[model samples]
Target: MEMFGKTLCVTFDDLVGSGVMSKANYKRYVREEKFSFMQRGGNGRKVLIIYDKLPDKIRTEIDTKNPGAKDKIKKQQINPMDHRLKSDSKAVEFYKKYTPKISLDRQTEYVLNVKVLNAMVALEVSMRDAQGKCGFQNNKEIREKVIALCENLRERYRHTLPKARLMEKYAAYKKYGYAVLVNGNSGNQSARKVGPMEGRLLLKLKRSKFPVYTDMQIFEEFNRIVEERNARATREEDKLKPIASPQTVINYLYKTSIKLWWYGVVHGEIAFKNEFMPQFDTKLPDMPNTLWYGDGTKLNLYYKEYDKKQKRMVARTIDVYEVMDACTEVFLGYSFGAENFLTQYDAYRMALETWKVKPYEIVTDNQGGHKKPEAQYFFKRICHLHKTTIRTTASPKPSKALSDASRCR
Candidate 1:
């Protein structure tokens, strides 16, 4: 029964709470009419009812019940200048270092411009006796009032100097004066090669992507496109695009947004799902020996052995079976040998002997040796004796479940 923002949406729960509709009727109504709604919140479970898109009857009903909806929405609306501002403790310590005596010869024009605008803002704030008071209420009012008064300052710098950004720059100005505004890469020739336009092209190319293009391949393609444009250009400005290094492409590719773009492409869909998709969080046993996890992998350590046919020493690794207590993640038993039913039995036996108590449940992967007749009989006998149930689950990620021994290997 409340309006929020420009969208004029309400929660389904709110509608039900206000007695405008029943949960069952809402579900059935949406289904029969094929109504469209927005989904949001964690796992997109929270449904939003858009008021404008609703049928006339429902919209009228909502309007009748929610009389103060417009007023409420206006009050709730976020002001552009309403921001929480705080002072850095280090600013006081840095105040003396940023005196008028500091040299400006090495500072870039852009830095000078930013500092000048910020200094004007600082002067206005001081004139109003608003110094040292960095609370959101005080600063928000100061910024809102001062921005209106500083017409020339706004015109010289960015016209749309956002209040939040202004507050940030103001803090920087207090800390390091003009020096903090100086662009670190302003004078570096090599760093300027992949400029903003080229960076945008790199991102665009990544979005319109190939499945198997490596970083180096993409880097070469990026330079090729730039070079091609440069070759066909008639004017000097059009031919000014510089050739960037592979490292620059690499750095751009690893940026947060770029990594998300290539997540499924580089690592496969399964890896993407494992990393980003919502998963069920299973409850663990409360005590030790209640549940156990068993898995096996080849040990990375190798021994040199003479191959009779090749008549040369070749390095080979042996399989290692391991059992871990589910609650504590402690390795209870392990056996190293060729992977088979015997090796698995040895590990399980070691665990049973050492722990002196049988686990109620044992989870393991569907390994070939586990299905062997001998292995089945042995497991069945143990289960019958200890009242244990063996369950098969997907193997865990190697990085998560690997042991100290695995790390050493």
Candidate 2:
């Protein structure tokens, strides 16, 4: 920081010394819009520079005391990166052995040569300032000789040529004094680029009624549409770029609409209800014969009857009526007859005759003859006379008695 270097006369090394704050945190502070920093030397050479705010009174006092503190501390070499690189004895060895080697292109090599020249100038200044000189007042012949030492470093380390684009690569480090700034997004990100056409196509495909379609199929359709639309394109660049890979499209669809994909590909409304839909606990009759249920169904088997007119056997069907105990799954009584049908009177007669004890409550479906108003009134009137309650539902849900019977069978 300028305050640390110029006003407080503190080198970066001394400012972060004794655990006042970490160099990493110092760099973070600068990046967080809390303060600003300026590089004194060329940007690559200015890696160590930082500027921290101070109180007005303190700044004035320091300025008075140290009239040219920046010039005085200019002798201090305060590169956290250089410090880290040189801290360990095996740094150079490790860097040489494990670091990736590079062969720069012609354009890259030329720019690096310019950075190398800047490095040479930095080396010369440090060398002269070490001695009793303030300018190029040092011997030009000797200065030039010493400065040339930094030039040949590129040959030793090829990656050293690109003299670190300070703002792009190490801006946070310079501002906040952090030696390591995570460059997580530094590499080529060409694959992650989602163009508008690709996105529109993906949505148009994935969110369609055809969610059952495979991503690859969607991708094919996507290309087809692109071709069709671009047939009218007035410019070459106006044509569509290709959509993402099939897997990527699948992943994107899953993230955006897992429920949509599930409903489309895995399950329908019935499966959804059976799986994720909630159900409430329902209380059942606690004692046997406390409740009675009655219902009728056509038997699956049919018998041949003699037809008087045709003088031949004709197919005839029979209906079954049953009365059940709600709690025990016991079929109390059932009536099926050749001459009898499932009328409301037959239903009432079957139920009244089936149970040995009078039912406290009776359940039946609101269907067929039993659904008539007169039939309902007859049951209610009979139930009232018998001190019983009659309940009927229009929905074809099986009673608990039927459920119990099913479980037993």
Candidate 3:
């Protein structure tokens, strides 16, 4: 019973050496637990800590015998650290990049992840520099000594070498590399809505010869298709499945995380190409305040105003009139108010107030309000006073009557 209690926690070698398991079964156990095993350094110095989970049967027995043995085993009880793992190449690389995962364990659970990683590195560095030129590979005694020293330090600074981290940090580091540390799952994500099959289905339906469907309706069709696939699935392992939420389909297929892709999906390929695909290689402005443009923009938010008839405040979005220096693309002045408040009168007022020396020329869109007899006369009088040229943008596809109306008005 004393012997059993003493050996309650066993390393891979301890179990195999004691005739409890064969080499083959122990390996299966290691893989099943996804143990983090670092290779012993090529030199006699530098031993890496190997953290493995206890087999469930062993764990249960320990807990049954000692009650709170689970918590004690996790802390200062001191498990095996540096027994070499097949000197596994892949496992070595995996250990280097993905030792500790991050999560709310750091926040809510208060897991000491940083201390563990730090202690691991510290033990390796101290072990990396041995005083004697004693051992390399063939000598088992010195290697065990180095590993023993590491486990001692781990026990001494138990907090620094926590057995388990709180969070999974579950990201595909193989595909995304180190970005998984910061970007998590969002990094290096595929542009396609999801994997190739769902993507192909989406593209097939969207770009088909038949009439196109709306995003919601198309996702419903996708759900039905997945259901059919699920129903006809011969084996559970062979099931070709899509995720449950329709929102995922929308996110993968139509979300504006990538605006250009969304535009291409909504508007035709040509429209997207014409609008955003063009490379904008351009030069700097020749000079500042050489010319100016004036326009009014409708602000997005609404303002509440007391209504005379209804005797209650009503919400209405306002417009903003602004003058800009065309050369520098600098906003010169702006004024915003109720919907009808920012008009040609406000535009002219802002332009005159903003300029220290009047711009050589001023331009505006050909809005009928800007072209009103009163407005044209007001601007014409203002330009004469300021000695500046005022011009309106040309109607690119002018109608005959519209052209005649413009000249007469």
Candidates in order, TM-scores: namely 0.31, 0.34, 0.25
Best by the lDDT measure = 1
Across 1-409, the per-residue lDDT of candidate 1 in tens digits comes to 3332235676786567777788887878777864456544355546667767777877777778888785677665433332223233343333223322223443333343454455556555563553343112345545555555445455544434345566676667566454455443544446535655565566555544444466677777777777777778877765535444454576566776546555665566777667665666779888987777777888989999999999999998888999898899989999987667878899999999998878777766666477777877877665542223334333233222222212111
Ranking by lDDT: 1, 2, 3
Position 7, candidate 3: lDDT: 27
lDDT of all predictions: 0.60, 0.49, 0.48
Please report, as a residue range, the 10-residue window in candidate 1 with the lowest summed lDDT.
400-409
TM-score of 3: 0.25
RMSD of 1: 21.7
In model 2, residue pairs whose N, Cα or C atoms come closer than 3 Å (at least 3 residues apart or on different chains), thus clashing, are: 1-50, 1-51, 26-176, 27-176, 27-177
Specify the highest-TM-score model's number.
Answer: 2
Off by over 4 Å in 1: 1-267, 274-276, 280-284, 300-302, 371-409
lDDT of 2 by residue, 1-409 (tens): 2333223233344335534457886567556754333333353443233323543543454456556665555544333212111123232232223212222343244344434444544555565565443222446644444434543454554534333443243233234221122122422335435564466555555545645566678768776777776777778766776543443455455563333434422444566455445555647799976776777787787989999999999998887777677798887767674322245466556656655366666777654456566666766754543222233212223234333321111
lDDT of 2: 0.49
lDDT per residue (tens digit) for residues 338-394 in model 3: 323246567557667756556655666665366556766765665532222233222
- Could you tell which candidate, 2 or 3, scores higher by lDDT? 2
Candidate 2 — number of clashing residue pairs? 5
Q: Give residue 328's error in model 1 in angstroms.
A: 3.9
